[model samples]
Target: MTAGRKRDAVLRLLRAEPLEIVARELSVTAADLSAWREAFLEAGAASLKARERDDRDEKIDRLQSKLGEVLMDNELLQAKVDRLEAGGGGPFWVAEVEAMSPAVSISTRRPYGLARVCRVWGVARSGVYRRRRPADAPAMPRRRPGPQGPMPDAALVEAIRGVLLASPFHGEGYRKVWARLRHAGLRSSKERVRRLMRENGLSAPVRTGRPTGPRNHDGTIIPESIDTMWGTDMTAAFATEHGQVAVFVAVDHCSAECVGLHAALRGTRHEALEPVRQGVAERFGAVEKDAATGLSIRHDHGSQYMSHDFQKEIAWLGASSSPAFVRAPEGNGCAERFIRTLKENLLWVRTFRTVEELRLALLEFKRTYNEHWLIERHGHRSPAQFRRDQMDTMPLAA
Candidate 1:
């Protein structure tokens, strides 16, 4: 209800009308009418004391108005002081002064005087005049040339191109090409070769994407000497009638030589062991137990690798089973890298009619890879050549 109506009801209640009747007329409860009556009486009594409060409130309002005026004056004074500090006329701070000085001096009509600008900016007038001097007033002294390296000749460029074209591997990077040039009795720095290659539009394929994180395993798979460790992995290729055939391969870690390869219809635990058996028979010259002692076989956590039969077979052959880190392919990077190469050169590039045909093809690919595939880390020598070189360096057993 409005204040006037509420006050009228309270007055009715004070005039001795029945509280329920007045409350029913106003559509409010009797309790609400009683509370309003009490408040009205209190307000009537407070009004008698309101004269002094009114005077005090007027005084407080005057004081507040004065405070607002004083604050506004202070703000105006602060604005003037800020303008003075910022150097009133044109922009006169360091950056602003530098920007405006040139244009102000060069103005066609009523050009601003350098002396006036310098005084406003609180800088020496001579400095303003010196900066405003014409660019053609005196030419800047030419810079002296520094020592230069030997320039690459056209012969070097041709040699680099020849090396790239002659490379058996596709997408050879500049570093490998540089190494090849060095091997061919041509002397040039790697940076020079890289520049030449870039200028000539000779570049390795660009691999786009975020690179992987730090490798989980250090390059301990390829040891200093041969036969310390062997990495084994399996890859699959489609055969026309056989659907898919799994080809298992074993490689010497140090020499990168494919020791053995076998293709079969199934990738069972028994089939996974075939490459290891072949490697053992060839490397040790026998299939007896404990023949290939002190050798470590590295493989992933595939069911075939983890099976009891495969584990027992390797153990009986005197080789320890070394499982790679779970979900970390870098732990078996050597085997994985070899698999990629095998797929690129043989498996993905060729189709087989049957498992037997795939087997024969895998055997032929193994021989070709071992004899011809060049390992750059081994001075671009084939795996077979690297193995023979290492064997020659070893002292004959007594």
Candidate 2:
């Protein structure tokens, strides 16, 4: 019922009308009429309480106002007493007296006013005000201001754009872009590059709403030297005719280099070992027993990775099999990060007609990534370049 009708029914109830009569007249049930009447009575009681609260608040506000006035008067009296006790001396210089005033001293317990200090010093308050302002103060020009500290110029912005365009991988963030610019001999700070890219709407799209949990892994995935550790992982992509195919990759932990890449029709244990075989053949020459005795392979706890044959194969190649923590993908984080990059640059952006096509694409992507995709930790050098640079620094064995 409308509020007006409810009010009318409530009024009839207040007049002691029969409940059934009111309910029939309002076209409502007798129970509803009773509920409405109860609600009206409760609301009336609440309104009366609210008026009482308002009156109490008004009285409290008046008391607080009177208290503030009394405090102000007390402060004024105290300030006058302090000035009187400071000792009224003969006329003195306004600046000298102003300097000695407790009001000007930041450490004073109770500060006095400038006028009171001038009165105590027996100097004209007008003269103290006159000494405070310089005749040429308003005429002085403010310091000329411009951009500071190697601001992003037009050429730098163009260089940043060129870096993004020339990148083999997509979704390169500002920090990587800045590092690339520095590698190209265009000197600029990370912050300036970030600001310019943000202003120009050249920022990478970010994923959101990821739930956070306690970190289960803390050790670094990137080792101190190359060939010490290699992280391997598998990802799937759709082939137009063959459905989904698996792509496996192996990355050197220290150099961030894609040492091996393989795509197969099946994601079995045998397929997982393809990249390892390739990496072994390329890095350690022929794959024989104890050929890569000092090297280790890091992989997650997938069936393919934990299979007996897979473990046996790595042992035969003389490489140790290091399984990541059961639930922690970060233990195999280097491989996982490379897989994401692969998706962003290849799998997600293109479709393959067959497993063979995907294999060729994976090989091409591996070469391009090793030659063009810059690693920030490696002084913005490509993985291939970084590996070559490290090889130069290695001491020759006798």
Q: Which candidate leads the pack in TM-score?
A: 2
- C-alpha RMSD of candidate 1: 25.3
Runs with alpha carbons beyond 4 Å of true place in candidate 1: 1-161, 206-219, 396-398
Give candidate 2's error at residue 389 in angstroms: 1.9
lDDT of each: 0.79, 0.83
Spell out the clash pairs found in candidate 1. Answer: none
What local lDDT does model 1 show for residue 264?
A: 88
**Residues 1-398, candidate 1, lDDT per residue (tens digit)?**
89999999988987899999988888999999889999999988998876655887989999976765455444434544687787785434454445544442221223333443454546676655666687579777543244334543567778887987776555667877877777777767777778778877887766685677767766566788888789998888899998987889899989999888999888999999999899899999888889999999999999999999999999999999999988888778778878888886778777889988888888888888887677789987889999999888888732
Q: Identify the runs in model 2 with alpha carbons over 4 angstroms from their true place.
A: 1-152, 396-398
Candidate 1 accuracy as TM-score: 0.58
